[model samples]
Target: MSTIFRASRPAFRARTFFQQNASKTTRRFQSTESTTANAAPESWMQRFWKSEKGPKTVHFWAPMMKWGLVLVGVSDFARPAESLSLTQNAALTTTGIIWTRWCLIIKPKNYLLAAVNFFLGCVGVIQCSRIFMHHQAQKKLAEEVSEAKEAVKEAKDAIKHKSS
Candidate 1:
């Protein structure tokens, strides 16, 4: 009976450890800091709560824009006539201008490299209207979300005032 109890105790501890550590989602979601003794923290829901500047959003946007420019440049280089049109060229130029302005604003030490990338990124943004459009949509969505939240808080305050 004593030997059987000892074997069961180790198995129970191993099972508990495995259950605590294993998750199929993001590592941030599985972190110990986010959890409690009674229940796991709602890490997934916490993603929506933007208390401050988030690194994930910034990281995602920069890389996505950079890669988008790369794809546009490659496509434009390969087949300018088919892959890009007059409107696309204009867009690319506009994008380049924006990027150059940003680079100047940041004042990177590697000015030459930054300038080249800025121009290249502009071309890509112009070439791929889809990417640009998507970015615009996302920007709009974020703005709308902020506005809506503010409106809701204002409405709540108005209700409280009336009730008082």
Candidate 2:
């Protein structure tokens, strides 16, 4: 029993030492400097420049650069509708919608990112629509051409039968 108590005594001391140091570390995290109400009011531009998600960070610039995609998408409107790719537009639309929602839901809402993503979604949707329309017209035209070919063959067969 004496040996058992001696073995447990060291463990008990170690536990107490850990507890005391944990409390001290918690207290050590307390702020030493007090912020006074006498601080000068910052201008809107200054506030924007210093913001964590502002021009200094990728959150702002990345979205700014993304505007190029939107511009290109808009410009592509002039091209023949048949040139648009359905798969590429569909992928852009999916990613744009997902990223827009994510940027909005994040801790710091990135409105610029959301705007760019929203525009991308719009561009993708428009392009997809154009592509679908072009494909539909092509399908209808192909069917009509096949029908015309069959009609000509039947007419030729009728003429051949009459001659025979």
Candidate 3:
């Protein structure tokens, strides 16, 4: 009886070991197959647009536009065209504001830069309005001057004809 028990114990251990290994292998295979089966196929457009390179290009161009507008605005400000400068400033400020909002969307917890951008945009708009008003006033003054000059020329021509 002791010899029979010893012989059967080894066989039992081997059987359990094989069963456990088989179960593990089966589970692993099933999980991989299920994941592959469940995954939806990506379209070419989706793959291209969502690729890492696409995001890199957007990030690069957005900042470049924002900074380029700023430089253009600064250089324009030095000239005498206040209205054009103000318009450029407004555009630059808006770009900065949009870029900051985009950054916030990408990283929601950061709000400091966004707030600054918003404030600057507001200031730019106000400045644009003021400059636009001044530009209009200047234009109106020039029109009036031109009309007065035309009236004076007509009066002079009338006097010359009467004297003849």
Candidate 4:
């Protein structure tokens, strides 16, 4: 069979394979070059617009969206410190610190993410400190009230002794 002769001749098959595919490969390689060559140089903004981490991709948008957390924390500024929860703030601070380090180590390095997380940590710490101070003040007031009551009781007993 001619098929057997063809199998025996690998050079003929290889030559035909290359000839058939060469046009397709060349077209792919050169498809966009000519149009781009006549274009003016791109500005930094333009370049960023089309870059891998641009607004079109999730990488940029995720960080932008994450700013909401910081805004929420900031909004709490009008709230009384006594209402703040230490556990919640501590969690935010811990998460912020851990991910801030992770952001720097990731491929391409997300500075926006790092900044947001870092600030998240800051907000958490400030809230925790406020709660701690409030608790401390309340505890001290409680101790003072206890001492005052004890002194009043002792003075009443002394009055009874004098009357007897």
Candidate 5:
């Protein structure tokens, strides 16, 4: 039995990690096209967005991690102090479940800590996406602007030659 359990533990963890990573990769690839949908051809934004993998992973894993942290937060707040009976621990667990589900559902904002955490999680997702998009857009704009300047310089040189 011990051998069976020991052999299974690593397998289980590996399976879980792969499952999580697979989903994360799927989300990133799916979102990459949309992230630069507005980018112009040959623009730095297009090239930059085309090369990234971060946005997709965040798109996939942010929700899962938020929920995990919620559970952890609940556990920390509900754990009984020293000298507590087993019954107290059970009761606290039940209470924590109820509170967690409730905050997730009805009165979320009433629990300030949970609310803040939730908001931060959402903001983090949006910020990550926005930052990537912004960088892409900036790169595109810079490249376009530089190209335009070069074109203008060439046109001016052509005019000078014609006048000479």
Candidate 6:
């Protein structure tokens, strides 16, 4: 029994040591000064990428738009139509523009990409404007149709009343 107790004493000491250090580790993490001292300074690019606006444009929008443009290009190539090609180009340009803006805003600005994006965005803007106008016209036509239907219903009601 004494031999077994002596053998277990080492394990008991190790457990106590770990328990004491665990609280210190937790406290070290909770203290800002200690954490900063231990952590390496973040690079400007890293800091920029971590920023709220940066992540949204860079991680989310940039990738989504890029993939969308790629798919559009592939579909256009398969079809080989003028309109489809134009649409693909417009979308590509818009994505480039957004990417350029994101690059410019972040650390290490990429002027070349920004210039390319700006030119493409400008070209695509024309296509986008035309699409916007068409959508507006459709909305106006729908409103007119609804108004006409309402008028027709009112006229029918009046006619029925007069007949009665």
The estimated TM-scores of all candidates read 0.30, 0.73, 0.45, 0.75, 0.30, 0.37
Clashes of each: 4, 0, 0, 0, 4, 0
lDDT of each: 0.60, 0.89, 0.64, 0.85, 0.53, 0.64
Candidate 3 residue 115 C-alpha distance from true site, Å: 1.2
Choose 2 or 5, whichever is better by lDDT.
Answer: 2
On the 0 to 100 scale, the lDDT of residue 29 in model 5 is 46
Query: Tens digits of per-residue lDDT for model 6 on 98-131?
Result: 7778878975565544655665565556555555
Higher-TM-score candidate among 1 and 2?
A: 2
Higher TM-score: candidate 2 or 4?
4
Q: Name the best candidate (by lDDT).
A: 2
lDDT of candidate 3 at residue 30, scale 0 to 100:
57
Q: Which portions of model 3 miss their true places by more than 4 Å? A: 1-84
lDDT of 2 at 3: 95
Task: Indicate the residue-level lDDT of 135 in model 2.
Answer: 88
TM-score for predicted model 5 compared with the true structure: 0.30
Question: How well is each residue in 1-164 modelled by candidate 3, as lDDT tens digits?
Answer: 99988876666445577777887787654553567668899898788577553444554344444444445544554556453666566775676668567667873333444554555565566557667887898999999999999999999999999999
Candidate 5 Cα errors over 4 Å, as ranges: 1-119
Superior candidate under lDDT, 5 versus 6: 6
lDDT of 1 at 95: 66
> Where is model 1 more than 4 Å wrong at Cα?
1-60, 80-83, 106-164
Candidate 3: deviation at residue 58, Å? 20
What tens-digit string does per-residue lDDT give for candidate 4 at 3-37?
89977877743557677788668767555558777
Better of 2 and 3 by TM-score: 2
**Span of ten consecutive residues with least summed lDDT in model 4:** 10-19
